[model samples]
Target chain A: MNYVLENIPERALKPREKGLTMVMDKGLSLREVEDVLETSGDYIDIVKLGWATSYVYPKLEEKIKIYKDAGISVYFGGTLFEAFVVRNQFDDYRRVLDKFGLELAEVSDGSLEMPHDIKCQYIRQLSEQVTVLSEVGSKDAEKIIPPYKWIQLMTDELSAGAWKVIGEARESGNVGLFRSSGEVRTGLVDEILTQIPYEKIIWEAPQKAQQVWFIKLMGSNVNLGNIAPNEVIPLETIRLGLRGDTFDHFLNNEWK
Target chain B: MNYVLENIPERALKPREKGLTMVMDKGLSLREVEDVLETSGDYIDIVKLGWATSYVYPKLEEKIKIYKDAGISVYFGGTLFEAFVVRNQFDDYRRVLDKFGLELAEVSDGSLEMPHDIKCQYIRQLSEQVTVLSEVGSKDAEKIIPPYKWIQLMTDELSAGAWKVIGEARESGNVGLFRSSGEVRTGLVDEILTQIPYEKIIWEAPQKAQQVWFIKLMGSNVNLGNIAPNEVIPLETIRLGLRGDTFDHFLNNEWK
Candidate 1:
């Protein structure tokens, strides 16, 4: 924001309860994390070590420290949670979170099947230890969960003590909230909005088009997740109506 | 690369003539450039400051110096050349190259309509100042060039003084050498290869599938361009058959 632009959207500041942007860290080296924090840390609220990548990323503890030191909450992707639960090592998963000094955890069953009650129980259990972000939706592109089920799952998870329910789109933005072609399931989102408050859900939208769709539908303060590190600045521009896609979105009627 | 693996493709070292990996730097900060170099510099041979981004980027010279110090060649994207030529700033463009102490330059008409003779003359002019890499193909997805035309342009450009001719696919890998859907024009590529030397062409393959296609087609030593900074290590794995996509491509017949 070098030049002050008229009709820019009002954006929430740091420690934001809303308009949170969660970035996905697949396998960034230590220096890459430092660079991301230095460049786009202000726009990011959370960093998700995507899926089981944290399990194999060599500098996992150091990476978490970098994010935490920057006052950004770091969490493991839900698939990592599923990885632990399916291996019957939920206790170990908790220990791993403690070992990494992570204050946030994501409980998701996208890769595996878990009974809803049991899922709620895991959310409840994880919430007791850390702020839980329970994800709802199957990673399987073929398995399209109905909007009603999405609302139900989100509500139950929130009731089960989760801080926010994450709508799964993976890192590709090609499942869950989006169709295989990366198109948003408008009807599903509309139906879910009837039950789940937009502020209470962080939609995983990795693609630029999906981000634009969310920003337009939910306004500038929408919570978004699974953002690539390189896209934080671009996403912020879109949110502030600085970029071409949203340039007219926040303009005054008189200007139009 | 930390552990030795049997049947891994022997990748050419830096200052390589072929098997070059030309990364696309789309407005990376100085720190980001350092991070990329520290993490994946060994796998990269050149870095292209993606399309006219060099003009808008704040720390262009510092970023280039970092890449140069890391023993990797750096050049402006071909679009920048067109930007200069279209604005009749060809002389200024050459001065900018000298101002930045750039040893490499790209001559391309991807976004503009330039006569073949005029394009070659620009290539010849730039070649005297720096090692020139002339790109062949249109940025428009609707504009499809036949194989013979591609072959003719590449041959003429090489004769004019291009060190290598680059096949355009843009950063999205959805134009020029590839279809709108990001699928490679296999027939066109095969026909072009029949007349053009494979070693003298750098295919702009920003997608994993396209990289895999080239690596499989040309063994492990094919030159590739427009690779994202993060994809360097992943591309190296693909080249070495360490990744699942090409795991069998380089393995011993007995092992298979």
Candidate 2:
């Protein structure tokens, strides 16, 4: 079940802090979920039920149990939280999470306009019960928050007891740190990195080039989120310097 | 089960010749495979067992049965044929196909070096036994065949009784008709279109933008290949002009 690439740096197994890989599950069947966990379970640290998809499936509890039994942390997407908040059902959302035994929660205002103080209060409330991974960025490409604002939000969220802050790239890897063509805006990434603790930030890099760019810029242990389930092993390969892009990078350096 | 976008043009269901979508299955569990078929089965016409991944998985027979039962055509990737050819096991390959009850096959020289005559011979051989889909273009980006040569090969394969010719894009979508950035080489695509019947060509467009571009360039009925399992519904949305990209495209046009 070892997904570590050969002739490259090895990563620590489950319960790992560094080199954590979070897979985006857009409604996979229970058996298929188990198959992926059986094959590449060691490499997966967290599984996020992708955007508004968790509510569509009827077997949510069973799916969550399968993921939890495999020692993988499970959480719903930030959009689902936004949906709950919009409906004024925060307590109902918490009850549902408790019933499903999901200990990891993602809090964000990506799809809604919520006040900064209100958002921070929710983060602090969730942090006392579960791992609170707050996200900073607007989901709509046209309504993207300024980079400095994003930095300020990340800093504030961390100060408000959020375990880690995620940078939103959505599923397409088009907005936020990436251009419409999916290329990383190096200057923006550099500006954000300078203001935040690299270890406490997770970049949602859903594309190969974006993953490679983040790995090269932030080194191998950079936390990446929103990875597709199928691309889990491929991302691990890039992280461990087994893929072509990093293979060349490591070969050129020959030291680290 | 209907994945058709309500706002856009509707496509013909299973057994469709035009606007056909062929998904690439690297390795999926029975439940995972069934879940995809349940959601987007109507949009998918074929499911290709990508490369030699079929050989690595333990339950090939069960997987094929599930796809077939869903009324979806199932076939092995062209790379598997190249692997059998390399080992001089074409007879064994045919036997394995019979045992699994596969009715479609792909013949290609993507991985192995083979002349046009040999490639066509395999196409003819497969066509007599099963529905043959030949693929043109090399897997290695550095060794890309010219557009004119691709035109000639695709024409020859069709003449050899192949049902359709797929232009290779691999899973990464970076090595064939696409650039390193995954953008389609528009001029090259147009050059190839000039020499081949549009209906007979199935472009491997794994990326969302590429899918949108192909649908726009070739119209909604253009046959596309190498689509990931999860993207079946999204690709259908693009083809029907339901998604934002195509929605905007159609909104600008007056005629339906």
Candidate 3:
């Protein structure tokens, strides 16, 4: 960034809508959060307290405050929502969100089974209080939702007041949206994109190869989520074709 | 660490003769280094600025100071040594170590072809300048060294004055000591231990499953290298058998 390079694709600025980068905070210490903010805060849009780590991560409020103070949105991972919902504590979950002063919430059934209508209802209800990001895939590798089901679920969630539909791949990037071998379900993604706008979805791409695949497919401004804190700079480089993987992808790209 | 847990194996404290944890710093900002030291300093014995990253990583002096201040030894990655040696800048490399106030150095032939005797001679020279950690193995996954050869190399490196001989896995944990799939070459490791003392060899096990494999095989006191910055806590938990992977391994472990 200190030196300008020709042929580098333009990346969307912070507060990005289409080229959003949502990072996964898997129990980072306060100092670590400070370091992340200092180093890669501008590149990051949202920070998800990955899975149920927020439930056990000490100083959750402080960590969230760090992100929020940096003008970055912070939300608990979708699994926490399911954890509360499965325990019949939806109200408590809302109150917990309020307690954390969060302006965003995730609705997901990645780890639990819920009726589609009920899932939509929860999305609609949370949308009133905070921006909702409803995840549309199951975490179980054995449970493969077809492309049609994915499109239907994403469309329904968006209609249910969800701001964005998250494509689940878990933190490992090896389930939902990706095969167990970490290969992208190319056909399923291509099918889902037919119905769901790329801007209304955040693909969980924790691996560099997957990030490259998505960038090649969706250009520099694709919405990506579940990125590790350390990878923000590397991902930005990939997006702008500064890294080897996408160095040639953006030479003549006009996807800014 | 805040609370005592039953069935936890006794882990050797720092300044330890064994149970060494060598972390890999692949271009962390100075603030990030502070966070790592604050969070996992006690568990980390040495940190390698991963694979020539120190060449481009800004504020190299300050970053090393942070680790040194925390009573932890820091060394440039073995690949950097290969880079310097290949360029015939061996003396310049030695000067750089002194300039950075590094008390440790690594000698490795992972990235290039070097006669075993010549590699040992470099190790002998570096051993006089600083504590040398000579790595043995090919970075090329296809260049397989038999189990006996692994032992021979490791034994010769240790004999040549390396404080510890590191088994190559190249951060990805998919070469050298491990298979391309990141599985430990159990037979190779078993063979190596037959001739080389496990205490003198630092197995590069960066992956969790690989870490679990080593912990189970060598008990809680295995010397592990190339650990990611964030995995230090998880690795410590595995060593203590507090994590699920080795929860039962050390529950009745007599080796601890």
Candidate 4:
């Protein structure tokens, strides 16, 4: 791809392990998906059908096919999984994934409290058939999980056949690794990084400042998720220091 | 439109004087435009080509025609107007607007200073042939305008033939009517409302929380602008008290 500025920062190409961007599509039309992929598909790695929205979204199969055709993995939000699991439809959930030809599944109990062992078992079981992305941390801002507990759950989930353990910040960026005000829990994130490999964790950063923070903290290759559709291009600009927030981040050689 | 819940507050239909939703388009493809109109066109009154994006945007005339055909008014952002005015190209700007068959215009001095009288003169002249949206308050967060002055400018602009004076919270919601933290300046907003008619002003509420504040304070009919393309449906829900934030706002007998 021709860039206006040369060598801003090289992002790992498609099928990349790091610098991954996962967009949260609440409900986009077939035309909308086509529009995004046609312009910014190279930057997007996956599209998460946000929070049980797929159950009601029109043309679900066609949308998934489009994303897959564009080489972007597509998965339902973990809330759908929880909804199914809560109703004892584990087999039905698998059937749903199979029906859609999905190979990536998100295992999250953010809204509901499931036993950690049971959560890991689901992770272990699902990872056998599809890539498992187990999410850690509660969805509620009031239900605080200690930093060490966050580390423990993440480590356990990763060990339990998960491909990548996502740190839950929700789509709103309130709760989990972030404060209700959308401020990053820097100390908590810093502590988690000490125990987990950065590439193995996809930070759910839906806000621009959060994206800027993650990019600045972990460089251009930080994996970010829950991004809005229109923001994919803007986020790429931030990742490569094409935006003002990261303009001097790569330019200064003091740390480089 | 079939809503999930019946009897939600009815928003004014198209050609609405209030409850106006203005989306900001920062260059979207044709397919994306179709997606927006198909899903939430009824909620959108105008689409602003953000900043100077229209200056370099592809198929600019085509995009405007599509939006117009969807019953949505289209206008260039105030930044573009300022850009042309700074270069003494007001006549050229008018020629461009006429060439595009745009019936709406935004007159703003947010990025740079222009004498209020001169600004009003421009508004008076532009309002003769087309609808004018004059923006009040500076774009710079540090350049704070006092509550009384904000009231004064808005009042004068409306009198000078602006159809609606926009409170410049910006697309980021971090300036003009708000603090850098995206918190509304309550005293300022309250002071402005004391003099200016609420329906005569379109509050630039790009954030959900900001939209909620406006909806609760001014009811569902409050004119809101700078909404992202995907947010039109979400914003409409908030207006109709479908969302949690304003769920009880319209239900209360005292509020009704």
Q: What is the per-residue lDDT of model 1 for residues A29-147, given as tens digits with 9 covering 90 to 100?
A: 89778889999989999998766555434556677788888999999777667655655667878888887788999988776667899999998898889999999998778998988
Candidate 1 per-residue lDDT, tens place, B32-134, comes to 7877776677778999988889888988778888988999999998888889899999999999999999999999998999999999999888888999999
- Docking band of candidate 2: incorrect
Which residue segments of model 2 deviate by more than 4 Å?
Answer: A1-27, A30-168, A177-256, B1-6, B242-245, B253-256
TM-score of each: 0.61, 0.60, 0.61, 0.63
Residue B49, candidate 2: alpha-carbon lDDT: 93
Residue pair clashes in candidate 4: B19-B221
Q: Ten-residue segment with the worst summed lDDT in candidate 4 chain A?
A: A50-59
Deviation from native of the Cα of residue A97 in model 4, angstroms = 13
Tens-digit lDDT track for model 2 on B101-205?
889999988987898898899888888889999998888888867778888888899999899999889998998788888989898899988988888889999
Count of backbone clashes for each model?
0, 0, 0, 1
The fnat of each candidate, in order, is 0.07, 0.01, 0.05, 0.05
| DockQ versus reference, model 3 | 0.07
DockQ of the candidate models in sequence: 0.07, 0.05, 0.07, 0.07
Cα error, candidate 3, residue A33 (Å): 3.9
Tell me how far the alpha carbon of residue A132 in candidate 2 is from the true structure, in angstroms, after superposition. 20
TM-score of candidate 4 against the unseen true structure: 0.63
lDDT scores in order = 0.85, 0.82, 0.85, 0.86
Which residue pairs show backbone clashes in model 3? none
